[model samples]
Target chain A: MILKVENLNKSFGGILASRNLDLQVEEHEVHAIVGPNGGGKTTLMAQLSGLSKPDSGKILFKDRNITPLSTHKRVHIGLASSFQITSIIQSMTMLDNILLAVQSLQGHSYKFWAPVSGDAGMRETALNVLENVGLGRQADTVAGKSSHGEQRQLEIAMALALEPDLLLLDEPTSGMSKEESGEMVRLLKKMKGEKTILLIEHDLDAVFALADTTSVLVDGRILATGTAEQIRSNPKVQQAYLGEETA
Target chain B: MFKFLENLPARVYLAVTALLAVAPLLVTLGSQPFYLDLLTRILILAIAAVSLNLIIGFGGMISLGHAAFIGIGAYCVGIPAHYDIFNGFIHLGLAISCSAAFALITGAISLRTHGLYFIMITLAFAQMLYFTFVSLDEYGADDGLIIYQRSDFNGLLNLENPTTLYYTVLVTLLGLLYLMHRLVHARFGRVIIGCKHNEKRMQALGFDTYRYKLTCYVISGTICGIAGFFLGNFTNFISPEMMDWTHSGELIFMIVIGGTAGIFGPVVGTAFFLLLEEMLSGLTQYWQLIFGLVLILLVVFGKGGVHGLLVWADTRQTAQAQPENDS
Candidate 1:
């Protein structure tokens, strides 16, 4: 296992966002989490990525306690995540955005007076990541000008640039067209066995299509965790998701 | 060759700066001490404005107490001279140190708060410094202090010579502008801009943004201190009014007018603003009213500043012409 979360609990004022949540992610597998809206799926990812603090919990990445670490430290230690709402430096070029990710990973960000665009090494790596995400041709385009799906792809490209051992993708297909969603599914499939991806997804078809194992969350608590086939047959998950979809 | 022509704006900027470089000689040819003094003041302020643009324009920090750094730098020179310490290097050292320390302490505190709160806290700190200077009765209090002797180096680049000082200020401004250009395009610059756009995203990508912002703040203050040193020498006097909140507002206005889109904007904006001030004040007693009207119109009508307007015009013309050609 590459990640172990022990009794993680977070509360925002009167509401509990994560409640005694215990989970584990094995290395080199695409593990997907499917949950209802407002079920604390994103909140869990936020804590795991160190964007928000858990009220009480121990988050261990590669067996090292990461609960106290910041988002950047988590990134430095081979943990990367994508935002559900598409976080990117929109004013910058698509290539520059990815380059910034790659630049941060390299940790020589204090290189003053040397042009970042002229950095052939960082640029090449960013381009490769862009190409991997099918956005190589849009490298010079300002990210803000790109289509919504393209910006989502750019965000994923940035996540890939961190070269994280475990990747957390939050709603990668949110607001995407059917075709764009298929493309993203294919992209994640391509990287499936090569990286450890903790995916939070809304589309059940996508979860069934890509997730090796699945965890179902309801009201900030895990309802079930098993192989996708097992989770599909599980009566509890059916009541949680199938009932919601029909309603 | 085509690339050079393609960048017409840059080319125009180059031509303008070349003309500015020769301005001192032009003053000599015209035998106009007044023009020389006006231009010298403009260059020093240009340097200060360009530095402020680094923090405000690029870093997304809206500092309202920027003039405090300038005042501190000027005092670094003026205070030393008042006590009969005339070493130019000592003055410069003091200026840089004081400005850096001020930036570090104030930036550490101010950066913790954001937006209007951040702006107000900075203004409040500057006012604190302003009042301290106002209380220094030994240093002439509100009446201000005059330097009997300018800073003297070991007979190197005597700052007293008008032509030499003018050229020196010009060269320094140009150098600082180029340096800023290089800095904003560098790796550190990308992070700063990245933070400006979405600090959380930058942090998510593993950048310690707070440290970067603080360092940038210090560098800006230090450079502004350099300008303050030059301003003190240029005027042969210093005052508490130098760091007034209104002066900081003017610095912000200068960058905004220049478009803050890039390095050249501040330089051009400084020229446009200071020259407008000189021209306006000469025309009427209520020149400020007219100046305010012009600034309001320019800011409202010109989205990104004067440079942005120019770019907008160029794009509009091309966009219009392109359809016609295709049709």
Candidate 2:
């Protein structure tokens, strides 16, 4: 197993966002969590990525617990995540944004005399990451000027800059068109075997198509866990999904 | 050739700075005293404005108390000179240390607050310093003190000669500007700008953003310390008014009039401001009203100050002619 979560709990005031959740992810496998509205999928992903603190839980990465670490520390330690909303530095060039993400992973970004953009290695690595996410052509363009779909791709490119062991993508295709969603699915399919992906998505078709193992979450608890077919036929999932049949 | 000029903005600034250094030699090859004094004053203001740029333009930390650093630096020289402790190097060192220490303390407290609160806290601290200076009767108090002579350099460099002092101030300004340029493009600069652009994202990226901001604040103050040393020499006098709130406002106005983020903005703004003051005062006794009106007009109609206006006009012309090539 590459990641393990035991008895994870998060609450806001009196309402529980995540409750006694348990999960384990294997290396190099595409695992996904599917949930209905306000099902706490995002809360769990936030905790796993160190964006939110769990009230009481043990989060183990590579068999070492990392409940005490910050988001950037977790990123430095080979865990990276993208937001459900497209988050990027809009005023900077697409390449600069990737370069910043890569810089975070490298040694001592506080170096005074060395010019960051002038470094061949940093530039080459940034370009490579941009290319991997198919935004290489737009590297010189300001990120704010890019199309929405392109920005989403740039988000993935930024996540790739860390060379993370696991990529956590939340609603990667939230507002995307059907064709764009298909493109994202294809991109994930191409990356499936090479990286361990944990996708939190709302689009059932994309989730079923990309996820090898699907876990259904409803009301801050695990409703079921199995292959897509097993989840599709499960009675609780049927009720939670509002009897709206899906692939 | 094109690649070199791709960084044209920074290059032009360097060229301008180089010319400013040699201006006295070229214009007053006779080595006249009056022209030398004019050049020295310009260079001093340039140093102060440059420091202001580091915090306001780059770090996005608006400090309305910038002149307080100048006052701190000036008083460091003036107070020591008043007591007959007239070592130039010691005075400069004291100025740098005192200004930086004050900046660190004020910055640590103020940086925890954002926007208007930060501005008010910094202004309030400067006022406190101003009041303290006013109450110190032994050093001339409200009347201010005079430095009978410029700093003596232990028999190596004489600061009394107008031309030599002018050149020294110019060179120091140029060196400090170079340091600032290098700092802005460094890893520390990137983090500073990154924080300014998006504080939350930088925090999420695990940057101790407050430390970086406070560090910048101190660096800016230290640079202005050099400016203050020049200032006391320039006027041959110092007063509590050096730390006054209006002087602080003028420092910001210089940056605004020149264009905040532009490298050469401070030089242009300072020159324009000082020259206008000289010309306007000569024209009438109540020239402040005219100056105030002109400032209002400039702010209302000219969003980018003079340099920004020039750039905007140039880009607009080119954009109209070559729409496809422009963004």
Candidate 3:
């Protein structure tokens, strides 16, 4: 197992976001969490990414407790995330955005005199990552000026640049059109087996297409965990989530 | 060569430097040495504004207590000269270290709270320093102190000469501008800029942004402190008034007026502000009323200040020229 969460509990005032949640993500498998809106999918992702502290839980990455690590420290330890709402430095170029992520994993960025733009190795790595995301031609385009689909692609590029051991994708295709969603799924499908991915997705087609094991979450708890074929036929998962989607 | 000259800001930077370089000769020929003195004061404050721009413009740190560093720097010189210590190196060393230490301590606290809270906390720390200086009766208290002599460089350069003093201040400004250019383009600078755009994003990307911002704050304070050192020598006096909150506001005003995007913005802003002050104060006793109106107009209509205006004009020229070239 690459990630293990034991009895994770979190709440906001009276709203239980997580309740004795237990999950285990094996190495080199795409684990998808599907649920209705406000079913605490994002809340769980936030806790996993170290953005929010779980009220009670033990989060083990590689069998080492990382429950109390800061967000950046978790990233340093090879866990990176893409947010549900696309987040990037809008004023900077596409290449610069990826360069920042690549720079983070290399070492300390306390270098004061040498220009970052002059670092040929960093430039090449950033360009290669952008090219992998099919954004090679738009390297110089300001991120804010790019299309929504492109921004979503940039978000994944940035996350991949960290070369993380596990990638946490929170609704990567949330705002994408049908065509864009297909493209995103194709991209994620290409990344299969090569990466350990914990995907929080709403698109059932995408979940079935990319996830090796699908888990149904409802009312702050996991209803069931099984293969896509099993999840589609599981009565509890249908009544809690999938049935509502079809109805 | 032509392509490089086509860049508006570069051309302006060259023209401004050349003009300032020969300013002493021009003033002497006109027999108005007072203009040179005024220009010297402008250059000193311009240094402070440029340093302020590093934190505010590029780093997205809006500190309202920048003048406190200037006061700290000036006093570093004044207090040393009081005891008959005239070593230039000692004065500069104290100025850099003292201001840097002050910035490091205060920045740690101020950076914890962001936006309006950051501004208030920084202002509060500066006010504390201002009051501390004011209460020291031994140092002449609120009335301030007089420096009997300029910092002795042991005959390396005579700051006693007004022309020499002006040149020294000018050189310092130029060196600092170059330093700012290098810093903002460097790895350290990129981190600070990224933090400004989105601190949360920078953190998620694995940067300890607080440390980077604190380092930036210290560097800025130290540079402003250097400016304070020159101010003390130029005026032959030092007082708490130099570090008053109003002066801090003026430093920010200079940056806003200059167009905070480019390195030269602060210098241009400082020149515009002082020249207008000189011209308006000569015209009326209540020059501040007119100045306030102009500032309001600039903020309301001008998107980027004076530097923005130059950029806009340059882009328009390029657009007009592009069609002719195509034809």
TM-score of each: 0.97, 0.88, 0.98
- Give the lDDT of residue B177 in candidate 2: 69
Provide per-model DockQ scores. 0.88, 0.42, 0.85
What would the per-residue lDDT of candidate 2 be over residues B22-135, giving only the tens digit for each residue?
777776777565656666787798889989888888888998888899999999989899889889988898999999999999899999999898899999999999999999
Error of 3 at A119 (Å): 1.9
- Best candidate, lDDT-wise? 3
Q: Please give, for residues B63-101, the per-residue lDDT of candidate 3 as tens digits.
A: 999999999999999999999999988998999999999
Sort candidate 2 into its docking category. acceptable
Please report, in order, the local distance difference test score of every candidate based on alpha carbons.
Answer: 0.91, 0.84, 0.93
Model 1, position A66: C-alpha lDDT score: 94
Worst lDDT run of 10 residues, candidate 3 chain B, spans B1-10
Interface root-mean-square deviation, each candidate: 0.7, 2.0, 0.7
Instruction: Give the TM-score between model 3's chain B and the true chain B.
Output: 0.98
Q: Show pairs that collide, candidate 3.
A: none
Whole-model lDDT for model 1 versus the true structure? 0.91
Please name the candidate that would achieve the greatest TM-score relative to the true structure: 3
Residues forming the 10-long window of minimal summed lDDT in candidate 2 chain B: B1-10
Q: Give the Cα error of residue A39 in candidate 3, in Å.
A: 1.6
Report how far off residue A39 is in candidate 1 (Å): 1.2
Ranking by DockQ: 1, 3, 2
TM-score of 2: 0.88
